[model samples]
Structure formats: structure tokens, C-alpha cells
Target: GMADETILLADDDPMIVDPLALQLRREGFTVHIAVDGEDALAQARRVTPDVVLLDIMMPKKQGWEVCRELRAESDVPIIMLTARGEEMDRILGLELGADDYLTKPFSARELIARIRAVLRRVAMDSARQASPAAETASDDDVVQLGRVTVDRARYQVAVDGEPVHLSQREYSLLMALLDAQGAAVKRGDL
Candidate 1:
């Protein structure tokens, strides 16, 4: 529905990469494979894919390092794949700015669902940012939420200047709720 998205699949194993690429293609994604971290990074910069499916272990560059480097350059959504199932590994990946993670041996259906969820959130965020009303509220615009204040111009949110990072959806939802002026926001509104 969104222009037949492209995906970069980074894994060293042909067995894994081949089948995954085929499955993704059957589901309408144009897939590219990278056998190492350096190749993955290079391919990502070259193609500017809609999403990345990154495996944690590989020759030349590990997935975590690749994820860090990628985050430094772009905000493209990343979903990490790892054979390691430790809680710390998952936590570390998220801390490095991965959008999501899937362990090895995961079902294709679950992987697809995760990809769709991340893409939906990203699209929603993009739309909210591009809204005309949001564009008009340049610097010095203050949206008050009880004791909380969102300064649009400065891209800051605070309960008296203590900063917070609210997701685009959270910010939009908060604005919608405030605009209702204590009236009930129907489920359909969200």
C-alpha cells in the first residue's frame, strides 16, 4: 500500500538470507542481502531502504556496531536479529537505538508483523509532522497540558522546563486530548 517498500536483509548465511529474501519478495518487498556489517552499511547508504533487517553476528562487522553507525547517519527504522537471547543483549540493542528485535528461529509471520508495526508508527509520525497546523506553530508556540508545557518552537517538552522525549504519536495524542478541552476524545479520534 505504500509503494512496494524495499528492505535490506543483513545475514552471513545463505540458507537464512535466501529464504527470507524469497518470502519478503513474495510479500511484495524488494529485498537486498548483505553478508557483513560493512556491506550492510554501504548498501543502506546506496539504496536508502525503507527498513533494515540486521543480524547481530557476522564477519567483518557485528550488527550492534552497524546499528550504531547507521543511527549516527539516519533515522531509518532498524529491526535487529540475534541468536543470543539474553536480556542484556536485547536491552543493549534498544539502547543503541534499534526499533525492534527478533531472535533467531522466529516465525516469518511474527517478523512481518513487527515490520508492519514499525512502518505504521513511522508513517504516522511523518504525517503528524507534516500537518499544516503543526507547521504553523513555529518557535515560541506553547501548548499547555495542565502543569506540562510543550514548546513547539524550541521542540521542548517540560513540566516547568524539565525536558522529555515524547514520541510523535504521544505528542499528537496529547495535543488532540488537550484540544478537546476535557471533553471525551472518542476511540475513533485516536
Candidate 2:
């Protein structure tokens, strides 16, 4: 099922923006467009979209700056779009708070899939944070925190009864935090 989400697409090129926005709208998303980095920031504040597709090169401001500014304001997911497919560029985007990165010439289908994946992660995170005080664990190694659950015996995690796939690192970090029992775990300990 397609969720009714809003997307803010920031790109200076009409070639990419026009077709992409139309495709997103066809997929049941409310699409908004911005032609430059400054305009993108303005629209983001005005509309507060569920996701942002940000192009790297733009007049007046750059994508990285816009991403930094936006991240300071909210946890809104941002996907950095670039024509350059360099490893450094991708790493920089992620370090700058982008949830994902896509090199240009990507198919619309691939982009849509990425959008959905990011949205699911965001939803699960919010659910996990809903009620931290409700956390509990049993002798059976079943741990429950807010809407999230971790069954150590089965190596499984779920949110609101739905399975949530986690990377090995994520699972390990979660375990570390759980062991802390509301105390702060030193970063180096993880």
C-alpha cells in the first residue's frame, strides 16, 4: 500500500524535476518542487514534507549547506541527488545528515523504492521513541520498549507487531543500550 506522503524535490534542472514530480504524484504522493537551494529551504519550512530529494548543484546555495540547515531544524529524511557518482561524494552526503544518496540517471522505480525504504525506517524509529518508559524485559530474553520488541532467543525485532529488519551493527548497538538499562553507554564501548 502506498502511504499518502508529501515529497519536496529540489533541483535546478527542469528536465529532472518535471518528470520526477509527475511520477511521484502518480504514485499518490503530494509533490512540491524547488528550483534552487534557497527555494528548497523555504519550501521545506513552509510545507514540512515527509521526504526531501535534494540536488547537489544549484544557484544561490549548495545542497550540502541546505542539508545541514535542514538537519539542524528537524529529522526530516533527505536524499542527496548528484550527477557525480564518486565514493567521496556519497560519503560526504551521508556525513552531512542525508539518509540516502542517488547518482543521476537512476530509474524512477529505483528512486521510488529507496523513498519507501527510508520512510519505513523513519516510521519505525518514531514508534520506538513513543514511550521509552514502558520498556520491559522477561527472563525468556524478550525485551519490549514502547512499540518495539526484541526477542534475543530468536534474534528478532518488531515494531507494532511488524518485523523490523536491522543491520548487524544496529542490532549490536541496540543490545548495548538495552544492557545499559537507561544509563548512558559510552560511545567507545559500542
* Number of the predicted model whose TM-score against the real structure is largest: 1
Per-residue lDDT of 1-190 in model 2, one digit per residue for the tens?
4557999999999999888988999999999999999999999999999999999998899999999999999999999999999899899999999999999999888999999999998887666557563344334478877798899888899999999999999999998888777788898999
Which segments of candidate 1 are over 4 A away from where they belong? 132-190
Q: How accurate is candidate 2 locally (lDDT)?
A: 0.90
Q: Name the best candidate (by lDDT).
A: 2
Error of 1 at 6 (Å): 0.4
Model 1, 83-142: lDDT tens per residue? 889798899999999999999888888888898899998887687667644533433377
